[model samples]
Target: MTTARDREILRLAVPAFLALVAEPMFLLADAAIVGHLGTLPLAGLGIAAAVLQTVIGLCVFLAYGTTAGVARHLGAGDLRGAIAQGVDGLWLAVLIGAAVTVVGVPLAGPVVRLFGASADVADPATTYLRIALLGTTPLLLMLAATGVLRGLQDTRTPLVVAVGGNALNVVLNLLLVYPAGLGIAGSALGSVLAQVASAAAFVVVVVRAARRHGAALRPDLPGIRAASRAGAPLVVRTITLRAAILVTTYAVTVGAVADDQEVDLATHQLAMTLWTFLAFALDAIAIAAQALTGRLLGAGDVTGTRETTDRMVRWGAWSGVVTGVLLAAASPWLGRLFTGDDAVRDLLVPVLIVAALGQPVAGVVFVLDGVLIGAGDGRYLARAGLVTLVAYAPVALALAALSAGLVAIWVAFCTVFMGARLVVLVHRARGDAWLVTGVVRAPK
Candidate 1:
């Protein structure tokens, strides 16, 4: 029998899953389109994507923090205030995005080289990075706006926007890449255009909602400061998480070099893309956890929060099993869909299987991470993330030094990085310490 809580979780998680899946669909489209260009181009996309994701991933706190703050206010019956806080988050996104562009675009060449891109791969990677940089503001705005809607318990809007944007991206990539003869540049441009369109759609939705609810559209200085303060620890948390990802990318690149295995690098990229896509699918439940947990706490329903956490965990674990089965079954065919390289596909199969086996662990970590964020436990999350990174580093370093195959690298990801995440998160979630409720604290 499905209770109201079960209905609520599914209501939020199902759409959130669709929306999250659309995100990686953009990248999947890019990989497929660019993969046809040849190995160097595909490799370049891998390098460029790592850099782009790292920068944007670091600022993901804009969404997480805003969602928590907005949900809390909405729970406390301050709908207008909730909208105002979300507006402040959008403002911060623009500010950060601008600063990143100013520093990132001009340095694209050097950045690609830093990723250990071979000379043949560097130019295209640099081209892709610089072009993608043009859309950072729009991407950041979309992240924050999505968070705002999620906090309001509305995931359907984001799902529609994301799905439509992904379809547009695919169409544009088809037209611009071959017909326009723009090559990898066309792929990057298509993604940028899609991001801008999605951001515009979000703006229209948010502005109308604000006007309807009498929320201030203009920026408020104190509110902005308060949002930033609440997000500070989240920023730290994001940094650590991004660092883990960045290091993994770097380790894979360098490890392939050490082993004189260029094809393995491409295979790693293909497998990692699948890994990330699956993660977004799992993160949908996390999004639900974040929203509902925040609302429950605001309503002073600790009992509900606890119960919801248990249900989400159970759902998450089973979802992981289902995802793993599907991924493993598809491993043989999955790589061929992305790239035509036989060598790359061969190497990708085993690596993907290893990744498949780890989905349950991934599901657990993602949900608990969201639960803590929703509970406004960013301080502990930040510190715990750093500790997890420290624990994972030696394993990553050893894997790189050993010049292990793609499977070993993934094994490190599962056992070292993700394992550490599971330990810390489970330890916290089992305790009552992370169940904080009330208004978000602004740092003194």
Candidate 2:
């Protein structure tokens, strides 16, 4: 990542950064609105979000997979390959999202119940979860579009689309969740609308780019199928990770109840929210790595990919440290946003403190995850992520039993994710032949 390459990467990453950041903005809005509704609704919303994310979160890899495959194709001077993946990615995303939308709507309540949310909490959670599930298709499309843009080294367009959508979300949330009086359902509606807008924007930009590049978005079927094949490993990895994280939420929630404390749940949710913020923010580096490194690999510039990945990892670490410090400093005010009860705030402070401390490690894990995905090392993602997430389940319960509350839970979380990433990243970096070769390997 020389200065010139850094600039080029930034040109793509910043937009991805902006768009991804917009995600939490919407979540924060939901939390704020639901917070105003009181403890039950807020808790329910948190549980709903967790459940929905578990089932649908795997779709997230569409962005990374598309970027890696498309960028490599472009780098290899195969505009056709890039277009094919883009088209196929869009179709694949739609297919998965549609299936989820259908299956999830019926199972929403059971999913919430499995998380041990109270009967009172389950209904609202189900309501919110179902609506959010509807947004999955558009969300995937928007994400996949970002991949296409990143491949072309055109990050700004996706960022603009994301911001535009975020702006729409904020407006909708303010209107629907409040004066309009839709309650939790309003939150879901706002999210879906925002995603739809962003997806539309991405499609427009992608179509325009295809025209400019003299490629067709309507890729040939054979090319689409081939690129689609290239994307499967990453999707499996993403879905596995999502499912693992989803189960952890249930474990944490049940443990909180068994520990005989309401604050346990609240505090953990607050800490996770903070974690989400840090993870999403620092993921910009990961996105940059995936885009640029994949481009280099595609172009047969293995040396460049190696150099850029190293630089991005360093950058991610530094940024994570800064973010941790800032988050720790802001914990007092941030805790108040979740709940103002002194006891709850007390529980929250320690959780945030430890969580903030782990930001650097978390950042490393995330950045590395993106790099590997970009490099097409996603086949092992399911096993790797499951190891990390599952490691925390018993620890969460044990900590809760020890009256350790949220701090212990987060500590366990840190350990699991850190340990899991440690092995996978090392394996890849150390020349694991099976996983090290990216999607865009040079012709023999």
Candidate 3:
């Protein structure tokens, strides 16, 4: 029984890990393409990307909220509810993605300008943002699909989409950036095209899922109503979480503006890239936490959910150790691969050390988020995130201002997330409250 349970947990977490890793691979490829364009171009890409992350992250409730609702529906065996979320979330995604693209394309320059992008990098940032924003509609749709699949315990579709999109992006990057001479714009364009392909691929999977597992509503009206109602809090929860993240990102932008800032644009970019990579990599455990916990919640097996959480968090810790060591070990080589600039390299390599070590903290936090969400506790997820941001973001900004170097910034980063994990862990462990009747139905 023990061996079987462990194997089952691994089954959920492995594809989840792959899916999570693939999500961040998109940006890493972009960073690589931009890095070769020389420092100014790279820096510009970094600043603009930060702004873009904030924007997209703010609206991420689309994915998280949808995932939670879908998971709950599946647990209740409401196939119609799951399908309803898939369809309605898709509708919501298209509109939201379109709005972002429209707003971003026109305001790309102004947004970067607001971030205090150096005069040299301003135009490049705008160019890059414009090209990338074109694919928002499709990208948003893909997010919706992934959320639905995750909720339904199907990681295969997301994995397929991720691989296909990444392959397309690589080919497009080679052709568009090199042969076509689109510069950074080509990088952005490549990503957009790749995401479109992913979206199309996922749509097919979603259709199949409906046919195989969903409740085949006549018009799917009832499923739609229930999903929409359940999804509202989730949406609000996600949007709020995103809003806080955006605020922190904005602080990073502000900190980047210091004249004596030890961390330049490339350095900042490297840190963010490293951060994104680690967070996504560790997110595999979170994905695991989500799937296993969701399944347990669906079946009303509270004990299974708790046990799964413990194992995944430990897995998260181990994964964090391995990832962090590798990143730190590769710091020198990574710096050389991306840039030849000695000054830029020195600053970034140290930051990489900080970035890597933070993975465990981040891993725990991310996994907790998934566990809680799967348990239908998005409201708590939202609150925890907001509180952490409030406490930690200011400290980061202050440290950055005091010394525009990587050490202070990273220390702050680690501290903030560690604090977050601790708080959540304590509460969950101390409370049997999660098992109370209707707690999942109407979570606090």
User: Could you list the CA RMSD of all candidates, in the order they appear?
Assistant: 1.3, 2.8, 3.0
Report clashes for each candidate as comma-separated counts: 0, 0, 2
Q: Give the TM-score of candidate 2.
A: 0.92
Which scores better on TM-score, 1 or 3? 1
lDDT of 3 by residue, 336-403 (tens): 66666677788888878877777766767677777776666655655655566677766766765664
Q: lDDT (CA) for every model shown?
A: 0.88, 0.73, 0.71
Worst 10 residues of 2 by lDDT: 435-444
Displacement of the residue 287 alpha carbon in candidate 3, Å: 1.2
Relative to the true structure, candidate 1 has a C-alpha RMSD (angstroms) of: 1.3
Over all chains combined, what TM-score does candidate 3 have?
A: 0.90
lDDT tens per residue, model 1, 331-418: 9999878788898988888898899999999998999999999999999999999999998877887788887756887888888888
Q: What is the lDDT of residue 317 in candidate 1?
A: 89
Which scores higher on lDDT, 1 or 2? 1
Candidate 1's TM-score reads 0.98
- Which pairs clash (backbone N, Cα, C closer than 3 Å) in model 2? none
Sorted on lDDT, best first, the list reads: 1, 2, 3
Ranking by TM-score: 1, 2, 3
On lDDT, who's better, 2 or 3? Answer: 2
Candidate 3 residue 177 C-alpha distance from true site, Å: 0.9
Q: Distance (Å) between predicted and true CA of 408, model 3?
A: 1.0
